[model samples]
Target: MALAAFMLLLLPVLQGCAIQVTFDGASIPENVNTASVQLFENRAAYVNPVLSQTFTEGLKDRIINGSRLTLADGTGDVDFSGEITGYDTEPLAIQADAVSTETRLTVRINVRYENFKDPEKSWESSFSAYRDFPSEQNITAIEGELVDEIVEELTENIFNKAFADW
Candidate 1:
């Protein structure tokens, strides 16, 4: 009975825990307090300026609110900046070329991130997204919607890579 009492008392200290980890590298500590997302610039023609702003803002929101990270304007633990490099649409599959029935809207982005805290490490990646719409030479409602959808997807991809560790 005395030995049993001793084991019971030691159980709490001897138990091992199973920790659920999310970060893949460097075990970035929680509340990594400060981030900055600059408005993405795009000089490409036929591109919407508002799209760039939306993507940039979306990324900032994801990191600040979703991951509990703070925001900085000039410098911080992390800095985000990028630009829209390409935006175009083309026929993905044509049927006899009779006013092509399917078109694909694609958006490309080049993103760069710096971890000043770790000068040796930085991340730079490019992500793109495309959506199909009814074929039309001139800009149409369907085409506009498709472009918006592609930009939205591209935005999510950027956010995922930055904060969600995707």
Candidate 2:
């Protein structure tokens, strides 16, 4: 509450100051005709279907809900495509008297953004997330949960990078 009150008090002062943020600087040209996002594919066999569907659908929904860009129903000006290129889990580090105690999950994705209205070159980006935790000697839903969080974060990240101009 104190922090909120302080923020409210400082809102006017902060308004005068430019908010400096950092993000991938992708150029979105003005007068885009339409924007289309293809359904993302899941290629990893070990990947949880829930995580895959949730992340892919969530991202598509976010774009549609948040952007002024129109979907390309065959005539859109811009095109966007994404695919799950990789998903793998492996032991990263061990601890406590040679007991395997750590594992990592890696999710790789490929994104393509293109301007169909002009000869503009497209943007292709690949990003991944990795998480490590105490290995239970057997894979469990814990890993799936971690992957879900990663997907949520990564989707938001990709969304921001692709359009928010953050």
Best by TM-score: 1
For every model shown, what is its TM-score relative to the native structure? 0.72, 0.66
Candidate 2 global CA lDDT score:
0.69
Candidate 1 lDDT tens digits, 16-81: 433223443223434356778888997566677577776777677666545556788677788888
List the RMSD of every prediction in angstroms.
Answer: 6.1, 7.7
Model 1 earns a TM-score of 0.72
What is the per-residue lDDT of model 2 for residues 81-163, given as tens digits with 9 covering 90 to 100? 77887888877666667766788888888887676756455578987887777787455757667777788777777777766
After superposing candidate 1 on the true structure, give the runs of residues whose Cα lies further than 4 Å from its correct spot: 1-28, 136-144, 164-166
Specify the poorest-scoring 10-residue window by lDDT in model 1.
18-27
Please tell me which predicted candidate would have the highest lDDT against the true structure: 1
